[model samples]
Target: MTLGTHGEAGLERGRVDLQRYGHALMGTYGEPMRVLARGEGSWVWDADGNRYLDLLGGIAVNALGHAHPAWVAAIAHQAATLAQASNFFATEPQIRLAERLLELAHAPHGSRVFLCNSGTEANEAAFKMARKTGKRTVIALEGGFHGRSMGALSMTHKDAIRAPFAPLLDTVVFVPRDDEAALRAAATEHAADLAAIIVEPIQGESGVRPLAQGFLAAARELTRRYDALLIMDEVQTGVARTGAWFAHQLYGIQPDVMTLAKGLGGGFPVGAVLAFGERVGSLLAKGDHGTTFGGNALAAAAANATLDVIEAEHLLDHAKAVGEHLRAGLEALDGVVEVRGAGLMLGVGLAAPVSAQVAQAAVAAGFIVNPPSPDTIRLVPALTLTTAEADLFIAWMAEHGTRITTEGTTA
Candidate 1:
């Protein structure tokens, strides 16, 4: 069960028993990676005894990487002291975490924080708030992924993901991404009835694609002009993943509502929606939204510690430096077509659809990367990633690039 004890050993054992004993488990994620036993810093040891530099960082959630001293200590201290009390009582960590989030968000006057357990729940809460204003229509972008919940899925882009659950909530319109003209048309066309315009500053689940900075600015402008709220989904791009507190900051835009998760808790489960301006915050009254484990003491403590370390260690600047190194190295490779993203959230475009093969080669070479799409490899390493580790990964890619291209299919 420990690292180095088995190479491809427990993998077989786990696979067999998982098939037998875990039959009740759904096949949603297609039987996750053999099994990850332990992680330290940016490395994870798999059940097969393979140690890999985790470039994905739990899909941008592990901003501090795995088992960070501060995060671990904070969670342990909070758990031993006061884990959870019912919502009837307030906690210091929760209040502090809320204040910290407001500071990062630069929330407008009358802003309020609504905490939750996951990105889906955050979006679900956002939807209810929008609904309370008696508005039924929402404007979403193509390739945007809100969540899997009924309300959130209605705003997601892909049809294959939504078709099975036919007749999803009505009045959700999907527009092409980064098209200012199209956005203008949609907003003008729906102005009379639209409630909110929801978008991700950088689309992570859709393969690390970034929206044009001006496009985001335009969304803010249009939403304001139309008397609709601008909802920025920062679940994967917030918490310094994009070299900023939130990706929208790069464009100098302030959204009315911002949803955050992933890195907010380092690795702990926490999600929240920061509603700005007096009007939007008050829309969700006492009975409008609630969650059981949203603001528990332990989760808040972890989040507080994560934010403290991010600022104390200046991880935002570190993410920018290391991410630039990684991106530049990938772009220099002979077969790479393009590199896209900001900070640690990166996507590599290959001339061919060999990204999956390249990912396997990377693992063999003692690195872990994610092939979000056949031709795109996404690297969302910890914000605290060091230059040496980044260079090591770059060197591995330089050596294997040609092999991956020659042995695999072209896009």
Candidate 2:
């Protein structure tokens, strides 16, 4: 199949690909909505050559958007030069990536970075770090999602996903989101055994819900008082996605440990754990943890390239301005109740529980969005997305919002 092929031949190819996908892949994600063939910037083309604006940005992973020139060139260069090296050896890209992350994070002296392959792995490492404190209990907020791996899953709050995998790490406790009193009470009750408190500054899975400043302040104070680590899971909100380098920076709170992925590698798979100071940095000593493909040359090159592009292009300010434009546009629509979140990460709150239907209609209208909850439509578009591109979606919503919300379909 050629890159720009279309028409009847393309449609037939798409049908065959979907059939193959059904037969060859697991049912974990049910079925993909479309057989995507290629992407550039904020747009993706299906196998049938139909294009759609990718508002979800691979669920907040593609910070530079798809097939970015610099990102692609960097990966190609690294792959040709030196792709992999075992943990026994260290490569330049790997070391440089770690240094860059620490520098970008403004880590104090003795801070450290541990690079891994996915958000789950980063959180799993974090779970071990908490356990290293010789404590057994950890606190996570209700409606918060860490990752799908066993250890990360243990920290997640949803019952449906967790119930299937019984006998998880029983040491973790859940608290209501943004409820300072509950968090304080939980910390006090478990102070003796509290290893850490893991939180998402803005909970992405439940909806783009930001934790209140006061709530975050309380968590910081309580953790300090209890001598427990404050772990920030910035897997979705990190890497300039929220206009800030990290979401916690927005509130002027620094966590002892921070987990990052998604946009870190732009589209390549990479995750990292940033230890803030000497105390937390030394938790995972030599041989305490390890990974095969964690910070290999190729992955590090990709991540470094992603960070480079974000800085050179001034994407941080771009995200902030475009995000505000989107928020204002959505809020002006008839069916929208409000807009939540910061930067390019936003949730359009609807006046009715019709987000699923609206999202479906959006795809039909050549846009891609996600309904994380029935009342919220998530927009985590590429940081490079322009205001003009955003207006296209805003226009669509303005034209179809009334019918989709009330009638459950655009047609």
Name the top TM-score candidate. 2
Residue 390 of model 2: what lDDT? Answer: 94
Cα-based lDDT for every prediction: 0.86, 0.93
After superposition, candidate 1 runs with Cα above 4 Å error = 1-24, 406-411
- Judged by whole-model lDDT over C-alpha atoms, candidate 1 comes out at 0.86
TM-score of each: 0.95, 0.97
Per-model RMSD to reference: 2.7, 2.6
Runs in model 2 lying further than 4 Å from the true structure: 1-10
Candidate 1 lDDT over 72-102, as tens digits, reads 9999999999988968789999999998899
Task: Score candidate 2 by TM-score against the native.
Answer: 0.97
